[model samples]
Target: MYCKNCGSALDNNAAVCIHCGVPNGHGERFCSNCGAEVAPGAAVCMACGYSLSAQKVAAPGAKSKMTAGLLGIFLGAFGVHNFYLGYKGKAIAQLLITLLSCFMLSEVSAIWGLIEGIMLLSGSINTDADGNPLGD
Candidate 1:
């Protein structure tokens, strides 16, 4: 193997580059398959025909669409759905709005959350704050 960041040879089991201190598969400057220099953001390596346009892998613990939607529908006034979706600001807003108004404005927050929940269930809001797709 080779370090894509520095074009230096790497052990087969190595996880990082000894020369540049970059992790394996972490750069676009060189071909990992052939250790040849490649243009930045190039889809294919000209020297070895290696494909570089790999799809981004989703995180293992991605949020669930059903859970988020249900939370939004049931506890939207408290911003539970937003919190689960990593939308801290929106969650805090909803929570504060409901709390500050002593439940007088809870209906407004609930409506907002219900709309967001519907959007999530309908696939309009598919991704989380980190851009990871919500799970089934």
Candidate 2:
């Protein structure tokens, strides 16, 4: 393996880079697969075919999973929980489904939101729209 932080080669079992002191899998400067310098925000390495989509993990989101799940369960027909979770597109779709149909189709969106709520509470849907892990 290679140190993503420093482009230095590392032992497969090493926990940190001996040259840079960075913990394994902690940096974005270089590809861990090929040790090639990576561009900022690049999803894949140009030098190698290794996937880099999951390179960085943002800090846990401030939105609470309980809060979101509860909102989805209670006011999911209006997609209030999705709005709070930054899932504006899904929220708008749900809201529009209820509004455009004059509540006739509200149950569809309601069921959708309810399922999402349950998933959230069950840890099946743990990330926000930004892909940040939800806070407990």
Candidate 3:
């Protein structure tokens, strides 16, 4: 294997490059397959025809869509769903709207949350604040 950041030869089991101190497969400057320097934004390596495009790696333990949708449906007035989805601002807004108004304006937030929950269940809102796709 090779360090994509520095083109240094790497042990197959190494997690980082000894020479560059960068995580293995972390950069696009060099090809990980053959240690050849690669052009920035190039899709394939000129030396080995290896793909240079970064693959989409799903985050471990992604949040569940069903859970988020249910939270939105049941506790949306308190912004529980937005909180679970990492949308702190929206969550806080929803929470404050319901709480500060002494529950008088809760229906507004509740309706808002219901629409969002429907959107989540229908895949209209598919990703969390970190841009990770919500899992089933």
TM agreement with the true structure for every prediction: 0.57, 0.58, 0.58
- For candidate 1, give the lDDT of residue 95: 99
Winning candidate number (lDDT): 3
**What is the per-residue lDDT of model 3 for residues 1-136, given as tens digits with 9 covering 90 to 100?**
8998999999999998999899877988889899999886565688998756434333678788789999999999999999999999999999999999999999988999999998888666777899887776
Single out the weakest 10-residue window by summed lDDT for candidate 3: 51-60
Off by over 4 Å in 2: 1-61
Tens-digit lDDT track of model 1 for 14-99: 88888998987788898888999988856567898876544333367879889999999999999999999999999999999999
lDDT of 3 at 6: 93
For candidate 1, list the clashing residue pairs, or say none.
Answer: none
Itemize residue pairs with steric clashes in candidate 2: none
Ranking by lDDT: 3, 1, 2
Global lDDT of each model? 0.85, 0.85, 0.86
lDDT of 2: 0.85
Q: Tell me how many clashing residue pairs each candidate has.
A: 0, 0, 0
